[model samples]
Target: MTQAPPELPLHMRRDHFDPVAELAEVRESEGVRRVTSTFGMPAWLVARHDDVRDVLADATRFSNASQLAFSLPDDPRSAEEKRKALAGQMLATDPPDHTRLRRFLTPEFTVRRMRRLEPRIVEIVDQHLDAMEAAGSPADLVPSFALPIPSLVICELLGVPYADRDEFQHRTARQLDLSIPMPERIALQREGRAYMEKLVAGAKADPGEDMLGMLVREHGADGLSTAEAQDGAAEITDDELAGLASLLLVAGHETTSNMLGLGTLALLRHPDQLALVRDDPDAIVPAVEELMRWLSIVHTGVARTTTQDVEIAGQHIPKGELVLCALPSANRDPSFIDDPDTLDVRRGSMGHIAFGHGVHHCLGAPLARMEMRIAFPALLKRFPDLASALPFDEIPFRAYHFIYGLHSLPVTW
Candidate 1:
């Protein structure tokens, strides 16, 4: 018999545009509070902005490598299998190992590289807008607009064939949905790994100019030498390559797509902000930042394990305890910004921890920002009269998933 699904932790819970009141209360009254994690493990929820940043910044005191210990109660994978599963997953590893992997991929995500891709991104956004307009109004923006733009962008970037997007997207969506049974989610994860491994093998055979091929050409076994190996040059293994690609593919699209869907709904709710984002080109950059801050989409940064006894916000946490940074709480902490609950596009949300902080900051942040900067204004420009088809309270929010977003956003112009 299978075990029951775990409850969604308080830190992950949200109420429409804001985090639940309880999370705010905790951030106000106690900067650090012990809570039961989704996996039923007792974890410390770091609620203040400063505390969360400090936790994320100090990799020595807080180790991400031990986070894997909080896996499903009935997971049957062997120790080696589990280790391989996390091989190149930067989010699952600490420094030195993570440092090596990130070095290989950092050049591809720089500002100059994103600038080079800007024209193509613009074309892709326009193409989707054309399709949405051609299909007429009353379309669900989730699939028609929000999902496909970033999905195609990441596919081309990673060298994954866009035709296979449906399968992988379904797998990833299910993989992150906490409502799904643990066993089924694990099965989906395995399936996604197998699918990516084949693509990794193809990239190894005849490398293309995309990121996977770049890794295969420069960091694969064929490219490194014994002398270089001694000098600390690392060759990315097949499992590692697959793991990294899978992570990029999922993150590259999911977070941005959700932002598009949810952000559109947010703008629709506040017409004045909507008008600002749509009419003023200068307003979009800061507007995107504000949206990301308000959304705080990912429930919490990856759960961290305490390497030594640590005191945060005057609360003592013993070594080997699981600690989570409540990102929504941190972003919404009144001390972090003025009028934390209100959505004001004019307020530049510069220091928000939306894409996370410290070493584990989202590698694809530049790409995500570029996509939003280009896509949001272009989308508003294309559909000047865009309005949500559903009522405010009727919107279907994907609350149980690791990422907060809309399941579907029906709209008309």
Candidate 2:
């Protein structure tokens, strides 16, 4: 078969985008196209929701445990120097190991527990607004607002000292983030490893009621020894502890920050939905979910690898190959969503892959939902007429790419 095109949709690179036209082209292209990533050891890209679902639901056929899923090396030497330090954590592991690790974290993220956190979330939202008002109008919503709010909240839960939150957020942003420059990301990962070791030691010696403390008690939350390594280890390794913290911090802040910027921009364009939320506080949570689907903040799919040769949608995928899940495609799949391109607050977002699905679904999803439910309403209520200060074309975006995010959203009331 002839090689397919390598060009990804141009709009995919932007922070704020409506890829309806682009996605339609992708849908047609994927049906016949043999897409490939420029990244080493190329694999076919699956852009249709059904193809993605087939890949996701059949983990045995399409294994995520393959190092190629994330494009990392599996060498024991690199692993000892780099790989073993963080490999086999929940996000990186498959099946039984993934299952076991996720078990320890399930309860902390339940919607019920998340509901109880709404009050605390409200205070956090309000505090950011309060600070914004005092600082003056037309504040950039990132550092002053969007980013710091969730950073602090997760730190509080993890028992990371307020003093260390800045560093933790910096390091967490690096390792989980694929958008940054490679050298910087590698350096940040190293910094994260050193920081987490100290934090884990602190939690080990003096456990608190926080999640890390609880991890110490339940998962042993202590340093790993040779005996523990033989058993796949636990309460935490330098990598596991750092990885968990990294996952939570990124999930907690990045999505919310994107939603705050992107969702706010979308809401402004959709007057009816914005009016509905402005009229009723109870509408915030579900509204947040809808916005998540609409924004699809993650923008791309989860990555998986083929464990065996399999025919999906009549297309053969060979063993030991990589697959990008195309999550944004799933959220807008015509089979599942009617008028998928249209933003509708009334639509059900429960099935949206905005937080992904199955075993590797987002653990901090509930907390993220709660944060937005509280944050959006309080933002509109306080400012009442917050408006972007810069032209839509000129608003700032991160120098780094991959993540669809605005670097600075200057808005004035």
Q: By lDDT, who's the top model here?
A: 1
Worst 10-residue lDDT window, candidate 2: 2-11
Quote model 1's TM-score: 0.96
- The residue-by-residue lDDT of candidate 2 on 1-413, one tens digit each, is 33442344332433355544555566655432354543434666565677766666776776666753354433223535555444435666777667766766788888788887778877888888899999889788777777887777887877778787677666655554444445566677667666766887788788799888888787773356523643555454545665676556556666777777777777767878887777786788678877877667675544577888877666777777766665666677777788888888866557777787767777787787777777777788888787888888887654233456677788888
Q: Which pairs clash inside model 1?
A: none
lDDT of 1 by residue, 164-227 (tens): 9889889888888888887788899899899999999999998999999999998888544333
Clashes of each: 0, 7
Off by over 4 Å in 1: 1-6, 222-232
- lDDT for each of the candidates? 0.89, 0.67
